[model samples]
Target: MFSERRERLRERCSGAGVDAALVSAPANVRWLTGVPGAEALLLERDRALIAVAHPARDRDEAIEELVVPPGQDPAVAVATAAHAELLGVEEHDLTVARHRAVTDAAHCRLRDLHHAVEQLRVVKDDQELACLRIAAEIADQALGELLESILVGRSERHLAMELERRMVDHGADGPAFPVRVGAGDHSGRARHLPGDRRVEEGDFLTVSLGACYRGYRSSATRTFVVGLAPQDWQVELHGIVFAAQRAARETLAVGTSLDDCARAAGRVLEARGYPPELDEGVGHGVGLDVEEEPRPGALEPWPGEFGKLENRVPVTVGLGVALPGRGGVRIEDTLVVRPSEDGGPELLTITTKELLAL
Candidate 1:
């Protein structure tokens, strides 16, 4: 599968008018090469030369097919010895100092690969989709276990930590992003840092998290009421956010524009008298990185200059209502964009969205 991915990358590089491309981004490297070790691929139209760091005995044996011995600057060594011209590199990831070294070693004009490699990664293959599926399942398992435990008085930070640990225990490479557990005033804030704020009666406890499996990531969020009885406003806000999220998720398909999906949800919020926070977009593409590409929003141009939603592309649909002074609500889910014939969007995160009053 990975060999095929590398071949696709080589074809993409050639089509982009570059003689050769030096993939330096960790995610890009992992995408092209199955070996998770620090490695670089010098891709040309005719051939691809991969250079991986010297590994321990176990890793060395495990990745013998891709290992490039130690004491060798893979990019520099390959560029110099290969006699390749017009080398392309990821300018966004390589620092000025690193770029200088690569250029100093290369005897040709160096150009920026920029988002070319990333653009190639926008559409996922079966292996990538499988990894994301497991990632979402791990997150769902963690969140499900959390719901089964006491949630009346635990600090938000502790809950977040426990969720992360559980994900790791359940076979995740790690937490895709920092676990967010916002309580009371902090609820509804996207990406809220976990804090010492304790869960209290009548308070809204919003938790957003994801787990990384292999190199793919999945994100999910759920808002819960932390008491026996809930405020009427809490119930109403949660329902609004939930409906908006569902609407957005339903809009995901192969040819659907990102702006259309975002607007579908944002308009729902706007109609409810809630000011839309469209800046974050409805969601973003997810794969090797937590947030990858093709952000959905109103300002994003149509026909997506970045890329379009292709079949098997994984993304997160998150929408929230943050009522000032009053606690808010947010609900999100990780889903894969599929052709309408395949039942449309395939949801990876399966935790129930019902507002749970604990």
Candidate 2:
């Protein structure tokens, strides 16, 4: 798998007028070679060479490495060692100082490796998908365990900590991101930080979390009502967000434009009198990085730049709106974009979307 990735990256480098690529981005380095750590530089040649300033554990020994001297730049060492003439460098990732040092040391014409590795990593192979599926399952188990516990009087921070511990117990390397617990008026606010706010009766509760397994990450979030039954407003808000999320998920056909999918959900909230200004476009790509490419609200590269959905790519369809001083609802799921012939998009984080009243 790593060899295939390196070959494809080299092919791209050749097309971009370069014979060699100096990949300094950690994530890109991992994609090209299995080693994961900082300050590792990759030089693509007849064989890829990794230069590490410090020791990094390599279980597979799949790629060769050059350990750098105390003060020598790894990028310069790798690039110069490869004797590259025209070389591709991660323009966005490499600092200006590093690029200049590499340019001076290697004396090579540097071509921008414009997010090449990210483009490659965006689509998941079957093994990657299997890992992500396990990631989702771990998160689901953690959240499921949290749901089964007593909830009255617990602080958001405690719940958040408990969820993270549960994910680890269920076999995640760690939480994909920080576990978010929001209550009452804080419920549904996107990316709310857990605090001393305690769970109380008649409060809306939201929990957003994910688990990472074998370097793959998946995200899932849910909001539920506290106590015997949810108040009317809680039910109404949950239903609106639920409908919006469903609209977005239903739009997840292979090859469909992502812009249409974002619009589908946004249009629903708009019709229901949800504030249009709070519209953060539906969702994003998920894998090695929790939020990678295909993020709807981020930059659009070109005309019709909104990317088309692809099979085997996993993404999170998260949508929520918060009215200040009032609790909100956020519903998210990590799903693989598969064709309907394959039973539509396979929902990986399935923990019942129905708004639950505890």
Candidate 3:
């Protein structure tokens, strides 16, 4: 599997007229090679070298290993190994200091790879999709268990920690991102940092969390009323957000543009009194990283502004709407984009999006 990815990368390098490529981003390193150490990858026409500080801990069986001499920087060691006439580097990720060091160490002209690894990671293979599916399942299971427990007096931080623990207990490597549990007025925000706020009766509660299974991650978010029943406004807001999320998910398809997804969700929110600025439209690509490609496009019209959706690409459709002091609603799910001939988009997070009354 790793070999295939490397070959594709090499093909890209050849097409770009680059003799070799040096990778430094952790996610890119992890994707190309299974081991995600403080390492660098040097890929040539027919050979690959992974320079790390600890050779004994090497977990990537797909490439050769070169341990940096004690005190020598792995980045320099790996960068100097590329002897191609033109070498490619992930300029977006490499720091200026490191870039200078790499330039000094290089024997060839350096060129920006321009997010090549990230571009290649935009689609999902069966193995990657499987890991993402397991990640979503773990996150769903964790949230489900939390809902069944006593939540009236739980602090947001406590709930957040509990959710993280549950994901780990469910066999996840760890939480994909911080487990966020927001109560009171903070509920429904895209990413509310869990605080000391304690759950109170009738308060809105929003839980946003994900699990990392292997190298893949998936996100899930759900909002609920803390009391035995929800207020009329809560119900109304929940319905609106739910509709927005559904519209975004339904709009996802192979060959669909990200703007199509954004416009569909934004229209629903706009029709129902949501400010255009607040319409942070739902959906983003997910894989080795919880949030990867297919983000919102640039303000100015340009090529690749809004990425086009593709089959086997996993993304999340999450919507948030809130009223200060009245709480708000947020619902999200991870799904895979697929063609209609084979099937519609496959929803990975099966947790009910219905507003629950805890």
Candidate 4:
């Protein structure tokens, strides 16, 4: 798989009119070489070279490894050793100083590799999907365990810490990202910092979390009322978010435009009298990085540029609304885009989307 990936990258470099390419992004490096922590990968037409500070614990013998001496930049060393007239570098990842150093050390002209590796990673193979499935399972298990315990008096910080610990206990490398626990007025915010605010009766509690397993990640979010029965407004809000998320998920088919998916969900929220400004897109591709490519509503490379969803790509559809004084609701899930004949999108996060009254 690693060799195949390198060959594809070489093809891309050739098409870009470069003789060789240097990949320095950690996620890109791992995706191409299956060796984590590699500082850089220099891909030639017939050979591949990796530079690192120390030998990897599990090494791949197909590529030649170069151990950098103390205080040496691995990227510079790789560039110095490349035997090509035109070399492609990940321009977005390399610092200006580092790029200057690499240029000074290299005997070749440099070209931007721009997001080539990231674009290649948008689709997943069977092994990658298996890893993502396990990651989602771990997240679900951790959240399920947390729900069974008492939560009324728990502080947001305590809940966040506990959820992260629980994910680790259930066989995860770590929380994919920091576990988010929002209570009362803090609930439903896109990204919240856990604080001393304790969950109170009738308060809305939103928890967003994911687990990283074998380099893949899964994200999920759920909101619950802290009392025996949820308020009418709470139920209504949860229903709107839930319906919006479902609409987005349903729009995820092979060749479906990414903007259309976001619009499907946004229209629902707008119809419910929420603000017309749906900042975060309905979802985005997820893999080695929690959020990678094929992003809807992304501002980078310019907005409305996320082309379309392809089959076998894992993505997350997350949407929510936050009222200033009153709490709100968020519903998110990780799923793999698939053709309708293949049962549509395969939902990795299986936690119930119901408005649970704790």
Q: Pick the candidate with the highest lDDT.
A: 4
On the 0 to 100 scale, the lDDT of residue 252 in model 2 is: 94
Query: lDDT, candidate 4, residue 204?
Result: 95
Clashing pairs in 4: none
lDDT of 2 by residue, 161-246 (tens): 99999999999989999999999889888879999999999888999999989888889989988899887888888889899889
- RMSD vs true structure, all candidates: 3.0, 2.3, 2.1, 1.8
- Candidate 1 or 2, higher TM-score? 2
Query: Cα miss at 197, model 4 (Å)?
Result: 1.7
Rank all candidate structures by their TM-score, best first, as comma-separated numbers. Answer: 4, 3, 2, 1
The alpha-carbon lDDT assigned to residue 241 of candidate 2 equals 89
Candidate 4: where is the Cα deviation over 4 Å? Answer: 69-71, 297-306
Model 3 lDDT per residue over 255-349, tens place = 78666877888889889888644446577888998888866565212355458788998988888887877668888899999999978899999
- The estimated TM-scores of all candidates read 0.90, 0.92, 0.94, 0.95
Residue 179 of model 2: what lDDT? 93
Candidate 3 residue pairs that clash: none
lDDT accuracy of residue 164 in candidate 4:
94
| TM-score: the better of candidates 2 and 4 | 4
- When 2 and 3 are scored with lDDT, the better candidate is 3
Across 1-358, the per-residue lDDT of candidate 1 in tens digits comes to: 6667767776766776777888888888788766677567676666666676655344422222345567766666656544567888889888897788789888788888767767778888887889999999999999999989988789999999999999999999999998999999999988689888888888998999999999788999889888787788988898889888888888888888667787888888888877777677878889999888766544333343744688988888888888787779888898999999989999999998988887
Cα lDDT for residue 76, candidate 3: 75
Error of 3 at 148 (Å): 0.9
lDDT of 1 at 295: 68
